[model samples]
Target: MARKASLSGFPEWLPAERVVEQHVLDTLRRTFELHGFANIETRAVETRAQLLRKGEIDKEVYGLSRLSAEDDKNDPNALALHFDLTVPFARYVVENAGHLAFPFRRYQMQKVWRGERPQDGRFREFTQADIDVVGDGTLPFSYDVELALTIADALSALPIGDFCLRVNNRKLAEGFYRGLGLEDPDAVLRAIDKLEKIGDEAVAKILVEEVGATADQAAAALALAKIRTLDTSFVEEVRALGVEHELLDTGLDELSQVIAAASKRAPGKVMADLSIARGLDYYTGTVYETVLVGHESLGSICSGGRYESLASKGKKNYPGVGLSIGVTRLVSRILAEELVTAARSVPSVVYVTLAHDDSWHEAQDVASALRERGIACEVASSAEKFGKQIKYADRRGIPFVWFTHDDGTHEVKDIRSGEQVSADPASWAPPASDLHNTVA
Candidate 1:
């Protein structure tokens, strides 16, 4: 029989890699909770109409129905797996509006599905960590800057390498396109979004051929897209493009304000990048993308933008802004590059060994004592020789091994440093820092 194939886009990791994943998830949960952001989860599926409201993303929606059941055929357009967290979140807020708190601050970390061709760093199934705040009435403009800065701080706290947050505003791009005498401003914005994939020359060609731009005008627009800087210097640089656009100026101002606010809290983390035109129809204000230093080619590991009027059920208007970190991508890159490694396999702080049948119960007692003290411990099951037991613990990456003797004595051994010390099981304690795996 042929070997069962591993699904293309569904990625799985071994025990050690899973340790890294757990660490990342734990860190995010702890940090978000510390900052007072409440956590919530919504179902993975939404109505087809809701998913298709933003027409551009329709290609990635994974529509679902019971394959074996005949009763579901009548509801053809009923359910589809969500492509991103933002849309589902909007639907969630509207459904539970009466029960939620105003200015509701929420953080959701879960798997989102997309029916797209799988590639490096892009998966059909992946995890996204999103943070957003929605108000009962009008959301404060300051929350825009606040959300961006909070996400910046969260990403900065991760063990991954240094990252730069590239921010831009939609109004600025729309204004510039409108000022250029383009009839459809959104068309121009969409063209600019392709700057990373299609080079400037191709984009210029498209602008002239498809969007009806003069050669000089197209060249100037392309030049503006190419202009990027680490700080607010991007403002002065884009202005030099000589494109008389009011929207560009407004965008520049918003970018400046957000950068100023973020810097005040965590200096030198946010930068204005004129090239970051996130290709999404919903983004109406500031946008964000994070790139790891020296690994720019890996593409954006975290991205989101502000959206206005997302909560309209064809009537009510609810605008909100937020960001999401591609946790799977970030962790994958770190592991691929060997940037971080787990210090141990299991969660046990110490493994109590059984030398013989007579000492097995004693070993269990010692492990129990350790567990009572808030330490994780596991007693070896087999009554293996002392040398073999120690080797077993070392092979599993169990850092500290406690060998029990019939005389109520124990020997603690550190596998990594090859150090062993005699101790009394009732009174011994591993240093607080050694209780958990330390990233090296």
Candidate 2:
């Protein structure tokens, strides 16, 4: 017999870990809904051409086809797993523009596939939670600030630790680069994006040697990258560089506006960081990347940016700004470090015990009653010793178990506290607060 090969990038977790994932998802969905973002889902597979519209993401696309299909192996046609929710969302907005409300706010949580080497905190298959808002004609500059603030608020609501929402303007970056006489401004932005990874020395080498920046220019750019401020003063600090370029000034103004607006809405949540040059090619205005304060080495757990035009239908233009939380990455690190946990084994509310073969139907009735009240319930598979059944519930982390006695009385056991109380099955209710277990 051959030993089974373990796949490198595909991650699977135990039931306990899955509970944590579910809790995270539930929290996100609730927060998004509370803020009036409608839910939307797009197909997992899209045409290859559509996926490759943005050149940077093309290499990471996981193209797929029928395994048994015999014809046309050389000329692969349209079919690839979605790499992120934003692209498909752009397609969705363009396809369904007429039906949607202007300045549409949407929340989409889904699995995205990427064909990249997996490593710690990086996976080929993972889930993302994306929230975006697109206006019909032209999005207001205010929408830009609101989008960033809302995402920062969402992250702050999570069980995760303090996170810094790093904000930058692509226009600002472009202006600074173009001011420096760089023809391909994206090349310089790409180099700056590596500031966290390659350090100041290596990034300076790339900027000066590879990108043809002057030694003085490289040092100045590195100083800009190192510029970090908690408020809008970052704009003033960058201006001190005295790049002598109109575009850089305009970029500075835009960054200043965004930071001021976000601060008014969510004080101390947003920070101005000149180094946050998100590598995506489509972003034309503001870009966002959030880092956990103590876990800065873990990288950005949430990131997104603004695009000038999401649709190129040869007609109307659709501009939008959005952010996505890497739910899988956040959950993976939290679970690995034991930083968070699920309160219960299952999401069920009550577990009804089958006391004996003759009492099975009564157990079903009890479960059905709870279900009628919107409680999730489960009945034991068969009558077993009370101790054994309680042990089963304990193993599953069931908080409460209901059992019937020979005297025609019913009892509900608070398994965690080991407290049992006699009660009428039809009238008994779990305390409102005890209905759901919460993480400690």
Candidate 3:
């Protein structure tokens, strides 16, 4: 017999850890809904054409092959798994254009698959919590600021520590690059995006060698990317760079408004970072990236941007602004750092022990009574000694152990504090805090 092989990049959480993940998701769902974003779901699979419409993810999409039909295996327009939720959401908006209300605010939480190589904190299969606001023709710039504040609020609710929601405008970067006499701003943005991974020297070399940029152009781009400010001072910093273009001026104004709005709403949660170039070409306005305070190496745990045309049906275009929380990555870091923990391994708050085989009937009665009172409990199956039952309850992290006495009285013992007291299952109940597994 052959042993099973554990595949990499596919995350499988243990029971206790899964509780934490669920808690985070629940918190995000509640926050998004409270902000008036309705729940929406999209299909997991998409046509290869739809998946690859973004241009960059052609090789990063997983194509399907049907064993039943071998002749059409080479079909170019076959099905593929969506690498991200944004692309699928765009298609869905167009498909259901007539039914959906304009300025649609939706929150989608689902697993998205990517064929890219998995690394630390990066996965081939992961979950994302996304909230997007799409409008008919022109989306309000306030939507951009609103989404950033919403992400900050959602992250603060979770157990993840302080984070930085770095905000940058693509228009700002492109306009500045053009003002510096760079012909290919997008190509330069791509190289500059690699600035952190490969050092400033390597990125500058790429700009001059590959993008046909002069030494001065490469130097100016590096200088622009190095700017980081906590407020609207980034506008002045860019102005001091000596680049002048009407587009650049417009970008500065847009970025200043976003930063000022975010600072007023979220205070220190949002920062102006010129280096953040979200690689997607569709992000025509503000782009975002969030980093856990001390865990910067884990990369952005949440990110997204404002797109002018998230979807199009003939002449009608749906522009939107949104943000996505990388749920799987955040949970992985939480487990690894021991940042939070479930109150109990099982949802069972009380373990009703059997004094003997004959006590099964009474134990069952007590269990039923406790459950009727909204207390989570279970009756021990075996006919075990009282000591053994305590150990059994202790092993599984069940906080309380219930024992029925021969006198027809009942006593509940708290395994955590070792405090035992007389109680009636019909009247007595566990504390609301300890009733269920808690992520603490």
Candidate 4:
């Protein structure tokens, strides 16, 4: 069973819960590696200047200072806990530009800290799994499609049942708003981004009153936001609005390429959602937001986009496309709803039982032999009765118990089946499914 955290926004999982989290991390690592993405880890702290380089998140940043240090004496450029992985990665790329290859492909999975209100899906400290492909000066558009497919494949491998990888192009939304005679497309995008939180009526009011959009223009913008399709049909849907701009044409073409490829390749897993404006102005091209089928209220469990100028060094720019998975958020929901279960709490597959006081040495020998054969087993702490030892193993979720007899013979019992058979320590092994703890 899991317990509540004494500290708000900080979660601590029980042993069984931890098993599920570990399995999730391990599975993501495997999938990323299979796609030839090398793993890298950044420091947990970054200078304030570095953290705020991309956006002004001062309120959400936790400043670090020595216990004896006074506020006035602290360095003007003091360090603080990193709130996201992208900023540190950008700084790392620029500092190490000479040593890295062009089109660097890396994946980072580490804890990030944010100073925000504690809520059901929000946490102060959580793990994020990120995969990025960066290039020197120029990054091809195909990478955007590749990232969508990669994320789709990774998520599909998990036990999370169904999901939709919503793809959109910033150019499409901005250009559409401009064609509709809206001066501030960013403000319109911001308003549309809140459509899910605040319903369409509220969004329309914001568009008309705040964004300076006429009623007809607001209606037209809302119509575009309502467009969603699994195929390239969204092109005609957007065109039906009778809006046109050079940028809009470019965005429509770019988005069509992505939806065409992703929809065909990852059928039923990808959709072209025009309302996904991403809220971030830096995303120049494609943006992605992912949601579990039945858990739409949880918002996007994963999100990211292409930033053409995230990092730069002496006039050269590093453009990249990436996505980050909210690991802790997903795991929390899984545990809270019992979406999946762990095969065992512990990794031990066999429990080596003791027959007598002198059997310690024999038990050790058997354990050593089994370990040499790549089996995991633990010897009894004392020469307890066989029943007591078996009970201990059962409590720990161990499947098999091995007993050494006075006649120098060995027998292993499957506790779940009550089947005991003669066996050799050197060769005995459990079924493949029982070899390790699994989460499903």
Candidate 5:
């Protein structure tokens, strides 16, 4: 017989764990809508050309084809699974530009696929919750500030412990690199983006060799990455670096404004950290990376940036800023670390016990009455003893079991506290806390 085996990259959760995940997703959705972002879902697959618009993620895209296809490459319209929501959303914006209102704000939660190798918190298939604000031409920088606060609102509502959102501007990093006399600052930004992963020394080597930076220049670039501040003080820190450029000055002021604004509202939640050079090449302005309090090694649980130039089609270019929560990665980390759990595995709030097989219909009737009142419940499959019936509820962490007495009246058993009380199927209800399974 063929043995059952689990795939390494694709993750499946038990019913209880799924409860926790769903709660997190629901929290994110509610928070996003409360902030005025409308819901939008794009297709899961995009043309290879549309996905390749970003230019850097082509290799990581999963191409779609059929086994019977003779020449997939020559199709000119080959489909590929979207590696992230941004690209598909961009394509959607361009395609729907005629109907969509200007300065559209939307939230999308969906699965995305990537062909990259997976380990720890990373996966080949994952879910992402993205909120974006796109404009017809130039978008307000205030939207950037708003997105930061909105993201904070969403994350703070979850069980993920205290987190620090390290904010930066691509202009800041690139301008600093340019001010340091690096001919290819974009390339340097790409290299130093590896600073957190490969360390300063290795990043410096890439700068000095591939990016054509001298030893001192590389050191200065590394020095900039070290500047981290909880408030507007990051302004002086960059000034202290002594690297000056028109773009550098502009970036510094812009970043300082965002940090100051965020601080005034959500104190201690947002900060300036120069090391947060998001790996994506599309980011043109403010970028963010979030690290949980003690789980720093787990990497950013959430991250995003501003892309001013996207899906440019014949005089129309979509510009936007956005954030995405790595849903699967965040849930996986919380589960693996035991950060939170569901109260129970089953959704049933109460289980109806059967006195005998002849009473099955009555038991089901009770269950149906509870359902009509918005209470979830299930009827016992067999007419077992009351003790055995209560044991069934106990094993599943179900809080209550219903019993019908000889008088045709009903009694509810609280399995947890050994408490029993008379109840009516029409009027009786479980406590508010037992209405549904919860994550804590």
Candidate 6:
């Protein structure tokens, strides 16, 4: 079970729960590395200007300052905790552009701070796993499809059930809005993005009153947003709407290619979700939002898009495609829903029993032998009775209890069963499945 956080948004898990979280991190790292993403980490703090330069996220940024310098407001370049990894990565790439290879593949897993209200899966502090491929000048759109496929492959390896990676193109959306005579396409996209939260009727009202969309234009925008398909049928559906623009044609073609590649590479895991308007402004082309099939209320478990202008030095631009998984949110849902659990809380597979105070050294020898054989174990803390030591192993969920006889032989007992056998510390080992903690 998960414990309530002493601080509302900063979650602290019990030892058992931590096993699941650690497994998730390790799995994601392995999956990303297999796809050739080099792991890197940036400082937790970036200059306030550097963070805000990427987007208007001032309200969510937490300003950093020294205890004694709290009142010193004269510094123009104040430090702040980064709200996301993408911005810092952009900065890092530009600073290290000279040393890095073109189309650099990187994976970053780190904690990010955001001053948002706490809710079921939302938090002020959370871990984000981001993978991106950045190019020196212009990046091909093929990476967009690759990112979606990679994320689907990674998530499929986890215990999380079914999920869908919703793909859309910013150019397609903005182009379609322009065809509808909606001059402020971004405002229209923002309003449409809330269609799931606020009903279609509410979104239409916002379009008319706030975004200056005519009733007909609002209806058309909503109609386009409602168009979702698993195949290239979305292209025909958008064409049926009778809206046309050069950019819209380009977006439709790009999205169709993505859907086509996904069909051959990762079917069912990818879909053309027209309503997926990522809230981030930097997404210049393809955008993605993923939701667990049964847990849609948890919102997007993974999201990101292509950014053509986020990272630049002088005339050089590092265009890239990426995706970020909200590690904390996904783990929170897994625990709250009791989706899975660890085989054992601690990593110890064997516990060495102590017969007496003098036997402690002998038990240490046994533990050393087990460690050298690539087995995880521990020695009894005190020279308790045999029954008390066995009980301690059982309580700790250690599978085996080792006993050293008065002479020279050693015997190990399976705590879960009444099975005892003579064994040698140098050769005995548990089954392969019991060698390490696993998700159950």
Query: On residues 1-440, what C-alpha lDDT tens digit does candidate 2 reach at each position?
Result: 11111786677777667777877888889888888899999999988877776666677887687788654323446588999998899999989988999889999999999988887668888999999989876888777787887787788778887888999888787787777777778888999999888799999899888999988878877888888777787876777777667777777787788788877887887888989998888888889999888888788899988887886466688888899999988988888777777677677767788877888888888888787876777889988888888888888777788987787788889988889998775677777765765554
Candidate 6 overall lDDT versus native:
0.92
Estimate the overall C-alpha local distance difference test score of candidate 3.
Answer: 0.88
Query: Residues 1-440, candidate 4, lDDT per residue (tens digit)?
Result: 35678999999998889998988899899999998899999999998878876566778998888988765424548889999899999999999889999899999999999999988778999999999999999999989988998999899988778999999898998899999899899899999999888889999999999999999999999999899999999999999899999889999999999889987889989999988988766788899999999999888999999999999988999999999999998898888888899988888889998888888998999999988988888999898878899999999999999988889999999999999999988788888898878887
- Evaluated at residue 230, the lDDT of candidate 1 is 51
Per-residue lDDT for 1-440 in model 6, tens only? 57779999999998889999998999999999999999999999998879887557788889898788764333548998999999999999999999999889999999999999999889999999999999989888888888988998899988899999999999999999998888999999899999999999999999999999999999999999989998999999999999998899999999999999998888899999899898888899999999999999999999999999889989888899999999999999999888999999889999999888898899999999999988999999898889998998988989999999888899999888879999999999998999998988
C-alpha positional error of residue 102 in candidate 4 after TM-score superposition, expressed in Å: 1.4
Which run of 10 residues does model 3 get worst, by summed lDDT? 1-10
| Clashes by residue pair, model 3 | none
lDDT comparing candidate 2 with the true structure: 0.82
Summarize candidate 1's per-residue lDDT along 82-192 as a digit string, tens digits: 988898899999988879877888999999998888776788889999888887657877887887778777877788868888888888877777777776767777788
lDDT of each: 0.80, 0.82, 0.88, 0.90, 0.87, 0.92
**Candidate 6 TM-score, true structure as reference:** 0.98
Which candidate achieves the best TM-score against the true structure?
6
User: Candidate 5: which stretches are off by over 4 Å?
Assistant: 1-5
Which of candidates 1 and 6 reaches a greater lDDT? Answer: 6
TM of each candidate vs. truth = 0.92, 0.93, 0.94, 0.97, 0.96, 0.98
Considering only N, C-alpha and C atoms within 3 Å, which residue pairs clash in candidate 2? none
Structure candidate 6, residue pairs in collision: none
Error of 5 at 357 (Å): 2.2
Number of colliding residue pairs in each model: 1, 0, 0, 0, 0, 0
Model 1 TM-score, all chains together: 0.92
Q: Give the poorly placed runs of model 1, Cα more than 4 Å off.
A: 1-5, 70-77, 238-246
